[model samples]
Target chain A: MGLLLTEDEKMLQESAAGFFADKAPVSQIRALRDDRDATGYSKELWLEMSEMGFTGVLVDAENGGFDMGFMAAGLIAEQMGKNLSASPFLSSSVLAATALKMAGDKQAAKLLPEIVSGKMVMALAVDEGGKHNPDAIQMTASPSGNGFKLNGKKSMVVDGHMADQIIVVAQTDDGLTLFVVPTDAKGLDTERTIMVDSRNAARMVFEDVEVTGEQVLGEVGKGADILNTVLNAGRAVLAAEMLGAASQVFQTTNDYLKERKQFGKIIGEFQALQHRMAHLYCELELARTSVLTALTALDKNPKSAGPFVSMAKAKLGSVAKLAALESVQLHGGMGMTDELDIGLYLKRIRVAQELLGDADYHIAQITK
Target chain B: MSDLEQFRAETCAWLGANCPEEMRTPMKRETDGCWGGRNWVFQSEAQKLWLERMAAKGWTAPSWPKQYGGAGLSRAEDKILKQEMKRINARPPLLSFGIWMLGPALLKFGTEAQKMRFLPEICRGEIRWCQGYSEPNAGSDLASLATKCEDKGDHFLVNGSKVWTSYADEADWIFCLVRTDNTGKKHHGISFILFDMETEGVSTKPIKLISGRSPFCETFFENVKVPKENLVGERDKGWTIAKYLLTHEREMIGDSGNLKPVAQMVAELGIIPDAALQAKITELTIDEWAFSQTMSRMLAEAKAGASLGAKSSMLKYYGTELNKRRYEVMMDAAGYDGLEWESERSNDGELARLWLRTKGNSIEGGTSEIQLNIIAKHILELPGT
Candidate 1:
């Protein structure tokens, strides 16, 4: 429980890393930004990932899944982050799959196959506008005949415009509830929210968006329980990705420090800069261990996943942010340019810091 | 069913039968356990008996060879014994730098005669050891030490001083590094040697630390003679052994940071209602837990024969940082009472003193900055000018 990674797990990580390195590189990430790709990622690479069994990693084997745990998905996310591959893997393959599987309802059965096959993109519309506090949820689901009518906006809905289905968290008479709504449903408005990271998300305004009784995820008034669990999974995956990004950023900066000569010598020769890089390296190791421990904790005790996830998020978010800042600062003028890939990591890290929950938000949740 | 299980059961049975009830409770003060040596005094007969019983069974150095008065258990079996002891809440039978730091080096590099001579005494708690690596001018740059040792054919004349030698005034022997040849590279011309603390001209002066305790000393060797046979490995090759032993020293220092839960500390301090303090406690606790997991992962990797190399620097740096945070939060939880000095209400300011003591944890066993340099050069492979 405390030690070595089994051979199977190691192989799973190796294959994913190899796949990302071969199929998705930083050049491809830059191309997407330069072309202003509407989807913000490649559909062909998504299918290849699905074919590699990554999309179904968390689903039951009976439902076209390999049944690998969140740790496996975390490994995939880590590799994808190294290449800065932008995709719905986090939104659809990880968070959505976790929500559906944890719910274990009829909708999961109906949608699991499509989601696993990469035919359907999914996003979770949970927060209203403020920070990622679950208690700030005020989107209402009012009674309208046989189903509920959804109103209020959900901001920063990751991959919302590209999604065919969106799981919206709304307040109803039964308290917080989750509903699976079709993206193109009546009175639904989706505005593409261009982010600093050049990633795709949408601000969704749900005006009388109707859903049937069967669309409800889990029991009424109990969506918070499922939402928390899904959010823990999201946080863990995010931590893994951040670790990868921080590690890459550290390596990139180290290379720059070695190559960039200043005053007739390499900048890496400077003791102050070396010490700073070393500090960042230690922080990266801490974040790495915290992320792995969080993933293991989730598998060991699903009920007690909150503190571990929060801890991982709090530590990794801070580390990733520091790594991004330090990497940019270490790379000097070249790092400030958009043409350099290091800026891309910095922007992505900044956005990811605020996603799921920022470090401060998570510290509040766990500490208080 | 398994051999380890059988060993665990036997260990449990023996400990239950032998460990005194008073010794089963938590150590309330630093002086609760026996640090065996010539100057050692047992806190109680139970403490003395406990060390005697454990030493008789050669469990003091459980993983050492049986011929050296050790149990000769495998690493897994040794771990089981530790778990069994912890399950019973049994206090450690003994703690000594001899057993922790020097024993491993001796086992690896000592001649057969030297191992037979020194290790059994360490196992039976008959001798105590102190390190002589750091000098005033050579704390982080330890190889630049000016402890000069001249070749006198059968013996060497040692003349120099070592600063920050913990418990040097009470030690039975000193494992020292001295400059054997100043003509070569600072690292190359050094040698590791051992000598009795009672040797003529050897003297110690205790240095009061910020904690107001004199646990460390300034040890001077004025033409003290150490036998040539006491020289470890080859002459002028002690830097390798010094670095090897430093890895263990760093590990030993880091491993002492197993504090109780922060909630338990709050309960003890009687401040369960303050949200600000609670938040600090929670944050520090999470970091400690993460650090523990990392340490365990590293331990497992070490057990699998994977060398940690420069990663030990990472462990030392983070472990000390976490330890400092632990005490800081404890002080914060203790409030005004934590700041009391030399008062009965504050255990004579024990908490405050210990909190200041942790500042030394980063400085000793190589400063955190030195560790960072090692990490940068070795682990991260950052090139130098």
Candidate 2:
């Protein structure tokens, strides 16, 4: 009923949605999913998207980025949702940029320009096993002379292989610290563990990773705190994208309902189905508002992410699942089959459910 | 200077100087929260005086022009006024459908005479108005109303029943949409008419809900003659006026920033709620703030004569859902309190009553379902039957 987006946001959404609709469609995703490399997105699409400013969405314009912040990144993710675009918009653009911004690192200045310019890619290898809580890190780093030696592996790293650098979260005696490691660094072994969507995976394995003191992303033993903040920002943007996926699927389901006749009338005409679609539509809109609020709240720092992401993850994670499940269930067997893109949306939603954390994890965070 | 700053300064200073301690707690009828207290009368003399005083100055209807019985405040000024009032938790001076619903319609569609006659009473809070639109069969499919409005040339006969009328038993007047032409399409052939509830054959039977207190009523019209002069707009054009009023209804559903869901939330989640929950509560409170800000912004846009079509649905959806969330929080907090279904508990901690009342929000003012249909079809370009 309203264009909750700003005028600039509207323009940004249009341009972004247009880019994904034209540049990244379902067939390309299907091909990527089936390939041995499981390369979800190609370099060409990445470069083209970089030209459109998808990579450095939150980066300042002078740094070859959009400077549009989390909202713009979210707009891109939303468009990506429509195409199930397997890109590093979430990992490199949003999560990585937030990390650099939080670290007060102008080095991201030298690095982000290349990343924003699509010449380099970065992924925050933040997630560890058992629970997705950043504070629950088991990975370790030790003081070795003037620099730190890292002996830890971050699994479920998005675009882990495609990244030029993986920001590793490690625990130190001092506290938690984040260190940037080159993808081809001596001790780093990247075996892309396949995801259901194939294009995205858990890049697992670690050796004695040596890095200079200068390689530390932030204060020693404080990376967990920093990563938590970054993920909250990521979660907000993730919600917007979740909303985009839900919205598109709702439209798809609505179209299917109208076109597919049943019980002597189009299914859309049935009050029962109409109410269900409408309910899903409400859920999507709720998620949309909640995400927007969280995006606006991200700069509040420590107090910000703790509550905002909890709300986002709890609401969006569950809401996205509902929308995805409803989209498929309401579509009948065709939605379940690989014949349509609906099933792919569901798989990706599953990945998002695990992206930052799941429903239970977020609920626990909020409760805690 | 920002109108908000000026307005807040002015309002605070005035209240500080003029607000009486007795008026601060505007005496309200004590009752179970669901069915608002009828036995309890407002005790604050300052409230009555301020309301009357504000009505004379047209300040209560802050955005309306002084020419049409309002304070003629700018959008920013209105925000400041509301914020200042909220800062004091000032009891609402005017609370009735007349202020929220009918005034907007009269401003839009009423004749000069109609405005002169009705608007002032609305401002003075002398007359209470209720809506009569829903029919037994036409609850959601409202256009299929069977309310007959046959023209007698001098007057129109309004004979039918409107169910689920909010406070109709207490209303002085009702604005109704009745089928004026049976031959036309179902959506067409309707005329908008206003009539006095005290008129012959006009009666109300209050429906006692599961919650105990009866808020809604079954309003029936038996050969009630509404003067042709009382017809709003043209004949068979009640649908237009009715649709216009529905926007106000939907907007009302959305704009509840004054109501705090925090207390209810605390009551619902149990465990007295620690700092973490407080932090979450703060986030929710901020969301409510943002939502209200957006509503005020939309109000400004509308005042500036910008077309704000489906945005009303946006407001309604958020408002109603927030309300539901408030109830959920309450129920959660109540834990055992919410589960008590005894008739005796209906007035007390009364979880059953609260739950019953919560169900009413979704059903009224076009169910959440209908609101979505409007949004999807109009806002998102989704197909609807």
Candidate 3:
């Protein structure tokens, strides 16, 4: 019932923070982007992360995971966000692992260990349009002999470019169903789309991509529950990351305010800027609690965590947007330049805000 | 079962048996809840009975020491009691400044004699207290307050006026800040003292606000006598105590965010507002959720021994501002009806009056600007100009 992390959770958070700071600071993003890295993230770094058991934060012990929970996973995600670290931890670890565990089919049980070990990368392709509307998915999974034939296009599929397998959401005769399809499956086309944040995604078009009944993540039409569970988990974890990013941006801006002088005094001395920072600090505190509560709720009971997840996502989305905008505005000229890490944060926050669900989307979800 | 669980069961059963059915419903008006005093009259017998029964069990001031007529419950137990009370939608037995503001100060700074005299009465809701801190000359710059208190051998003669003394005319006593000396810093000469509002020279004039209500008053004390034992804490060191009491005040004000959500209020009115207004209400609802969680986290952290010093300012600022916004949306939802003033059907324009009252929320305790300044300078460590 408490929002503050337990002692063990705090220790995990601190260690994760240290790991991200040392191994994958924001400079890592700059390097990968400059090098035009094929994977858009480092595999070796992800392997090390797996060794640290971050990749297994949500997987069960039977599947060779830490079996910690969403709170642990969120803590790791938050650190990754602080460092602007690029990885498929969200796609392969949180999203796919949650979907698989919830499905608990033979294929899921077989793939769970691989995901936990970082030996297999999986991506959940849920969005079929420019905007995120999971329920409006029009991709068809028609009947085929002992299997289904998929026909659809999914845009903005996270880690889709490098995934060993892709969990595709398509409409069946009953309703929406999720299919675990290999990237190399026939009639599947994957085109890497490098987002402004320098993260990896793909425009995926599936034409007559056949998959057996065993490949279905859950029962046909019953996939809505599993899909929602995966989406909510992603939303809550993304909120935690956004919280960390917003906090770091605030710290950086506050530092600049102290160091930068105007009218013969530090700009932080100006009441105008100071009040704005104070207001943002208040918002960040609220967002922090929202994110923490959401993650805790998800760990405690995923079914009832919907409203909490929406609150966290919406609150953090708006707050992070403010933080990014304020960081740029406060930094003045340097903020506009890509040379400073502030712009990188701005781009990444924008991308994350749009991912899973944006403020408006989540607000609609909550109000409806 | 654990001790707390057993205590909770007993408490729930006791409340169900003792709390009157009339008292289980929300207070229809501010006075519907008992604010006990020498001259006070109860609105209903249930109100009086509710106060008496709760006070008899020393549950009115649950966390205070048992010797001081409190139940002496642990924080966990007290929380459970509050939860149980809230579960039944039971109205608070008593609401008084004596319990909220003055009792804490007395417990911390009062001598055993002072504690013995005031604490029991406070716990029993026998005395209603008003604050005498702000003056017309001192609003946010409260240290410059110029209430005179001259020592006259065995007693002190007080002569001064306090503005924004809420419910001063109805209060039985006052916890006042008077200037005992004027030689040192403005903050240094102040002394905290208590006196009966029924003293010959003490008088209060109600001050009408925009809401057309006079919850506040201008309280005057002209050459009033007070015993030397009336003063709490060291002479000329009332500033520290004043600051400490203000933290509690801010926390109390910030907890106002715990009110029913705006959307639910709107829904109760049977008005599904336009899309734009609905969006505003939704945003407010989400913010309220976040703010509630933050309040819980802050309280838990404070209980865990974290200093909530300047952080209280952050809460006060956001909570009050959020409350103001909540009312604005509420008024917007009410539309033309919100403009109704002094009408019987509108409950004497309760919504409009409350909306206007929320405007003072950001102004009272400390102005939102003052809170921001404190947060910026203390919490954020921004440089002073």
Candidate 4:
């Protein structure tokens, strides 16, 4: 995502782009519209992605990962967004893997290989029902049998129902803590919910779900630090994905304007529309710069990644929202139909704009 | 050692030895800038020493060929020289419109004799130049300029006025666009010519701006005769040269948007209490940083000789917009205290005047609207209506 990419990064981007283009194209996503699958993605395609080592993109080499940095992960995310690929790349590979890595030895040694081999799926349960506050862990983690018992609810958990294990952010007597509770653990319940974007999420209710001492990630009550690190990386990758979606949709709309005629000429001939498209390109390019900067900054120092990551998310969120609106408006009636790919981008972007904190949330975060 | 690093070390040594302490301080006002011309005098002995030392080493115009009184450093080395200069906070030795605008045109389009005659003086800061492109009647529609020049065999007799000529009264020479054969399209028959500001029938009237001081003038050229040798390129074909020169001009204006980070201002202002203002500053800081990174990338691209083409218009619009936003924030940060005028405590209301001056940044190098139109037409390849 830097101005100049290394040959390895370039190759990764190209191969990932090609793979998504062939395997998880928009048509493949559209097929999931009526799919009864609980995961909201293709298992075969996810397996193919794991074969490509995408699942281990952020994990350490000792844990069977490529040991590539956040920028490399961003490259994959961008490509997936371009294809409108429905997968757990973010929920599992990016968010959960980052959490485990930041959680350090004990947790990663046990769970990461299973994730790398595509045998396990992990979902991070951080945001509660209210606003997107990374530190607002209302879920209680009480001491129980030398471990902890979690009791609360997590809403809009991406790929939560399909998660083999969930990293739950909850408050303890000391402060915030993370407990990696098995989805099948007693007193835990997950209800599948279909989002407006046609992806499946879960509202997880934890009724005194007990976790062992070994299940507590990192130092107890230090989950806030771990959550911040994971989410910053997550938000940056999310911004990259949103950029790819916005860029592709912008390109699609521009091409449509050139071809679609109104009155007596191609719609793109209108100076009014041309200016609008030009402005959109500017926003998109600047947003791209923000993404690259966030990725690069996070790679260097995770602690300082908050502001840069928030900038990228806020800027790209606004840009992607603009792209969605303009793409729909520019495409006219066709954009409203589900058959068209433009609406799909709009739906996905509308969802992405909210995930990992929306523009307004991040603007407030950095502003505060 | 890599060639550039070695050159960088040598440049650092030379600049350390030459750049005066007085020159190393941040330029606090417009007068601190060394705009070299006939009327220009060194404000201090240190200023004179610094310029003389740099110009002697042919570094005033680093990348210009050695024959043109330049160091003839490669682009990479030229960048290193800039880095070295900034490392020590070195003020630019010579600032001239001649070096930035007309010199490139002359090197590319002028006769060999013209290059030999004019470039050295420009590089050495002996002759300062002001542009004479925009007339009172032609602004955004610049090609419609009707500044007529009559062909008189031995000379071209010009009779017209140029508006918004920055520092024209103090500039030594003017590179002007004159109407030579306005018999065809509006753009046709335009000739680019050069002449001294002290020529007969030449005069300038300063135009007062909202900034309280006049840096621009209305330059009048009535029956001023310029030698046939002073004409750049071919007569009636100067429009090409004019367009080429505008690219450089736009680029210069676009770069003006790279202001220092707002954190420095916040530091100067002490603790800011308003959360909204703090947020705005943070956002602006990030944007400024990103914009600078974009500029660096563009510069690298330019060094590789890849034409930015109409993308310069994009840069121009964004850069000016950024500059305007910067001043707006600074004024806001100053609160009501920034509204003072001609007071020593407020440094003659410098910040307030600067905020007003930024209004012209967008308008001068083609308005933001015009740049957007250019981007839409050329960069976006949208059909013209």
Candidate 5:
């Protein structure tokens, strides 16, 4: 499956859609909002999903995975978007696996196989502050007597609670550094945080955690270099996923309009309603095109992916947010209900948007 | 390479190897038609040769269906062919409204007989089409036009004056809007009609411009008989057809934006290459990229079967403005040469004609003001003027 998916992908997406509809429905997500310890999604279905290659989508076939690259892995996320499925793929594969690839170390490579097997959980603990911007780093990493002592809180860590390993971002005297700390390591504290999306993220406290000097993921002070490249790829995948999510919101609202009647006719029959739907549809398609072009451009000009990456993030991020908001507003009172699937989309969109730099942040970076 | 990739590579190689050699120039090279716009003189052998070759290959209408004399390539394939053609610096097969506007309309709304008849001829470069729109008073308020088309039972007698009719004097045929009902509201009475330019009562006088080019014409039709079969769609419903045709026309103008801006190209390929000029070129390329994305999105959305109503106006407005900006830059790149009106001394003939003639781009088809109103009413839901 490439920029335009093949027919088999459409069928695969349909099958995934069927699984989500039958098992981990919206009600399950709704019930998990207040339960501090409640992690939603069915484990049996997750195993089934893992069997379907949801776990190691971009992993090499040699690692007991499908070697479909970002494009195919991206489509699954997009379809997962259809139901606002709160899977760990975004945190583990797109973020952590991406960082590992950047480090290109023997340890990171060895960890990939384990991570892909769905037997291990991992997270890239970047973003020292609430900001997703790399420039926001204030965490300190300094040489201790034998190795290194890391001190700083990594805020808004996805899977930070359940992650077996946290790839923490810290600043050294040289520059920004990324360190892989085992979640069980002493002096590390993880506290659960509530998210609008019902997915659990955590605020992590790292107080003088000692690690070997070799525990750093890549070359010292070069974490920003890897972050930019990984984020570029992330931006494209995020765009594809957002496109998928926005598409569902558009569809759900459309379905509701068709089902609910006003003035003795379907509200969709009104020209005013039709034009608003049409305009939003146009924006979604435009965002989709920008994403496809960005991906194609990335394949061609791997060197200049920075601007295009930011462009995709800037365009698709704001557009997806708008799609979610508009879908709810257009749906009227029922759209905001926890029962409807549209609310799930809005919830997930808000969180994922903040996961990356928010729209305005990315847009400001894009002005260059 | 995969078969499709191999096919694409081979196709590009072939186009690169076969594009006409002598026609490649940074200077003004004449076409079969020379006088520009209304008085266009077909004088260049290379232009004629290029057109015949492309039309025969069906590359002229790549996205169009093969049954209607098009290449009928898939969207991806069509995009590849277009990129290859650009890489080869191929001059357009035909830049006429016939290929871009009327042909697409005929394919969509034309009777099967019309498609079988006109599309092949259009594809083969056997027809020359000119738009018969715009009038002195009806320039921006196009729907308020008072041109008359009386139904004479056997045929419709068209009598009116169309101003700024590009290439009306040189064109073989004209597609126009004329009033078939006078008493109804201004917009409802108008009907879109097509007729032969050589009809006895039809004549055109060139409207010369400061650029020594005549892109506009004053067309007068007196009792010109157009066959009833030439009536596109319904008579009173011509507004619908005209509006639909306008979308295709706006899109046509928008799609034309994929070309490198004349000034940008000159800055890169002309005798003078400088850093400041190259920066401008980068800017234009970005605009072109954004515009290309917009047009591509339109096609993709349509293919995906989503209804995209009225956004064509937005495309038209941005595109026409971009085109004007492109031409302005072309004039800037031309420097002192832009002031030279004599065709014999023209630096880049196409560039010269384009720079001067493109002034009407914002004015032609639908005016920029009309587009603003469209966006206001149809898109923004603003109160009517």
Candidate 6:
């Protein structure tokens, strides 16, 4: 596979770009943040996204999905990032759908259509602490009647408060296990955690919540492999999103450099600023290739995609951070005001950098 | 198999049968590879044989037209040949400025007589060429070169000197930028010309680098007469050619980012890196991978007929930075042994010396700062003061 997008992929990317720009621009996120919308993202936009066939990008044709693959999904993610559109695309469509598809059981088969129809939302509750350390899960799952009882706290559960169901990672006698528990189940509590980026996430506390045998995803103790597949897919697509956001930030900053005048000349005329922008451009280019390589590997060669995914996440994390900081600094005093979109991007990029796996986390993984 | 696959299979078979065992090994040193010239000596009989075999098939200059001593392979075919050769770990048959720098300019702007005369020898590796673009005062500001070329009724009288002319003392010929008129912008009134290094009043002196090696020289000419036919392209319009050649030069330097990875070097040296050192190596490894992908994407796009233009500056800047960081990590991984100077165990302090030499990577082929400026002004279209 090549680094460039094919004709069909480009067309898909263009359509996604047009849809997001026309329907849910950055102003949508601003409105959500100002109103403190209980759902965090617009339900109408999510339905439109499903209608656009974005939610089922990875599902098979038998399940009524586009079956277009992860590259197509990544292109849509990138457009969403550029527009700063809020949705459960990552949490439900990419992460939950991939987990279900990989599980390939009766439960997954039943849930796939619900996700595609936008009738149900799902969240992958992996992280237990402040940072992403999936292997260090302290949650426990014990036998309860014919099923299992889960007792643990899952932090940073993307769209957990809004999800109809949550995929919980808990420790079992065999090892790590995955259980799909309904959000309305007894003794399960989900508290919405409003993030600075104005995105939705929740802290879920499960106290003796019971799940049936059918709720278990894949074989018990073999959940690590499935979880890894799900996480890597998420990391690769998230990296694409970050790349798009960083590119837009750079473009906006560059345009401002040409128009904003200081000391009787455009600030862009300054060699210092020019050099910084140029370096950021180089970094964005490198990060773009990293993201594309990882997504292509995921679509074409899934078995060997671990290191590529880590590299893309790490590279894009650092580059997107730089892009945000430079945008703020180059925009001068106006950048600090809430009225400008630069601050919004800075906050969002900060959240994205720490979301699945930060640069340091991924770098450690690469060396390991 | 399709036509390209058929070509690949044939090419693979041909390389397997033709490339010698000794020639399949990597060069131990830069000088171990053949760079054919009038006064050159072969490092080994295998080197001579490989050059002859490849040149005979006109594969030495794979994509050039057959009339100019090449196989006239399409870009795809040439890429396949390279991939096949790399599969065998084969060394390049010949390495010369004549092939990389001068040949492309000649192909684009040379007259019929010039092409017929110079292109064949370049393909056959009969002459080694050195670039004579930079003078003492005209490095980054090459357009301000004062290397005067006086017009005469029968010939051109050239004076002044060029510094940092790589391998000038060993080269048989020089493609130089000469000042033909002093009236217009500094970029104007320049002429690109070629002349024999052994001409009367021509001389060179090797300049030693921090690596304790002398791969570059200062070349001087005092009233050296060049034939009228030696000029390439229009007089006073050589800046365009100079700019074009610089792009190729930048690309060549950027390609140096493909150096053997630092982690592999540490592994070969049998060093077990600690946690911190391992992290540094891993970071470098990832950066290297990202840089390589960028390089390949740029090349593929260029092959698809997209103009690289200012993007080459980005490649040159990032590639050199990545290479420099790789060496730094290498030195850290090497520890005290990396400080070795003048020792056989260290290959005469090869790693240390090469590490020191990487200092020039960001400085040469237009400094990284200059590349940034070009990217800003051209690619980003940043305004000027």
Top candidate by TM-score: 6
Alpha-carbon local distance difference test for all models: 0.87, 0.75, 0.92, 0.86, 0.71, 0.91
Docking class of 2: incorrect
TM-score of each model, paired residue for residue: 0.97, 0.87, 0.98, 0.95, 0.72, 0.99
List DockQ for all candidates: 0.67, 0.22, 0.85, 0.58, 0.09, 0.90
lDDT of 6 by residue, B1-385 (tens): 9999999999999889989899999787777878898998987888898999999888999988999999999888998999899889999999989988999899999999999999999989999999999889998888999999999979999999999998999999999999999998999999999999999989999999998988889999999999999999999999999998988888888885447878898998789999989988888888888888988888787765344888889988988888889888888989889999978999888889888888899988799999999999999999877
- lDDT string, candidate 2, B1-385, tens digits: 6756666777789866655555455333323111112222444556667676667767668788787788888766776777777677665567768777888888888899888888877776777788898999999899999999887878888889999988898778888888988887987888888889889999899999877779899999999988888987878877888888888888777778666556554653455866655555544554464466556556655746443677787778767776776666556556675676654543454555766687777778888777877766675554456
B213-272 in candidate 5: lDDT tens per residue?
776699998889999989876786677767777887776665554565554467553647
> With candidate 4 superimposed using the best TM-score fit, by how many Å does residue B96's alpha carbon deviate from the native?
1.4
Candidate 6 local distance difference test against the native: 0.91
The TM-score, computed over Cα atoms with residue i paired to residue i, of candidate 3 is 0.98
Which of the predicted structures, 5 or 6, would earn the higher TM-score when compared with the native?
Answer: 6
TM-score of chain A of each: 0.98, 0.94, 0.99, 0.98, 0.91, 0.99
Candidate 1, Cα interface RMSD:
1.7
- Compared with the true structure, what per-residue lDDT tens digits does model 3 show for residues B1-109? 9999899999999999999999998766665668898887888888889899999999999988999989888888988999999999988888978888888888888
Give the worst 10-residue stretch by lDDT in candidate 3 chain B: B299-308
**lDDT (C-alpha) at residue B299 in model 2:** 69
Q: Rank the candidates by TM-score, best first.
A: 6, 3, 1, 4, 2, 5
Candidate 5 docking class:
incorrect
Clashing residue pairs found in predicted model 1: none
The alpha-carbon deviation from the true structure for residue A367 of candidate 4, after best TM-score superposition, in angstroms, is 4.4
Question: Please, what are the lDDT tens digits per residue for candidate 4 over residues B1-385?
Answer: 9877778778898888889999999889878988776677889998888888888898988888889888888777877888888888888888889888998899889898999998998877788998898899999999999998998888889999999998898888999998998889988899999999999999999999999889999999889989999999988999999988888888889885325677687568665748778778777776676676666666655647454778777777888888899889988888877898878988999889989999999999688888888987887777777
Cα displacement (angstroms), candidate 3, residue B35, comes to: 1.2
Model 1 complex DockQ against the native: 0.67
Choose 2 or 3, whichever is better by TM-score: 3
